[model samples]
Target: MEDYYVHPTSIVDAGASIGRGTKIWHFCHIQSGAKIGDGCSFGQNINVANNVVIGNGVKVQNNVSLYEGVELEDYVFCGPSMVFTNDLTPRARYPKGHMGYKKTLVRHDATIGANATVVCGHTLGEFCTIAAGAVVTKDVLPHALMAGVPARQIGWVCKCGQVLDKNLHCPDCGTQYLFVDEKAGICKCGGGE
Candidate 1:
């Protein structure tokens, strides 16, 4: 028996692997060789390209296109209109895959804010926050708050996506999270082993 949910307007190709309890909403297209995990949700007008890996419990909002070489770890949040690019250079005459492509990794529990642009070859650390409209060209550290053009670290964020309070604690849930020195770049929180 099938376990996932695909909307009537959505098209999931034959080679795509969609796990149990996932919900793909309106006008979505899941291309061949894509692998989507359980309990994930893709909002309207979404496109998941071939060879993409979408982890369990991820939430992708509307107008998102997860192109090839984009891997989203479990519990990741992709906000509305976010864009992930695989190929750095583009020409109408010169096709991609001919020049090769680099991958972008969004680690577990990371939150990518609305309209963000994730340039290829960067690793977004676990529980990291990429602020709205940020263009990420470099790797982000865990629990870091990134904003502005090209995305520089402005502050720190908790795993719950809450801005850390004065004591580096989550004011909303009282869950203590990690904070690394801006210079040292070391990070650990409640789940640190």
Candidate 2:
């Protein structure tokens, strides 16, 4: 008995692993070797390529394609038509398969807005926000708000996805932030450890 629900038009290959409570809606395809976590919701016209791994509680909106080498950590949000690429270069005659694919890691709680294109081999940090239509060409910092064609960090965002002021405070959630190292990102002030 399957614990997850896949719509009649969607196809889950034999070797795919879909966790309990996942809902794959219309016209989606989960290729072999793809692993989807529990509580994930994939909307219409989606594709989960081989070896792609999606973490738990992730919400991917309509028309998204998660290509191979793409890994979405827990609680990630992919808005409508967000594009994730695997290969940096391509040639129709000389196609490089998985060997040429570059890995992309989207850290926990990050939100990629609609129509954004995430280039291959970049790591999107935890809690980062990529605005719609932005093209990310580099690794993003945690809590950073990125926008524009070549997606540059415009500001920082709170864990609740609200923009932060220069004082590093969240207006919406009333959370204050203290800067940590590049690896640790931001920490709650007064040591909300």
Best by lDDT: 2
Task: List where candidate 1 sits over 4 angstroms from the true fold.
Answer: 177-193
Over the stretch 1-193, how does candidate 1's per-residue lDDT look in tens digits?
8899999999999999999999999999999999999999999999999999999999999999998989999999999999998888876798867247788999999999999999998899888899999999899988888998989988778766788766677776667654456644535456422
Q: Residue 68 CA error for candidate 1 (Å)?
A: 0.5
Local distance difference test values of all predictions, in order: 0.88, 0.94
Weakest ten-residue segment in model 2 by summed lDDT: 184-193
| Residue 156, model 1, lDDT | 76
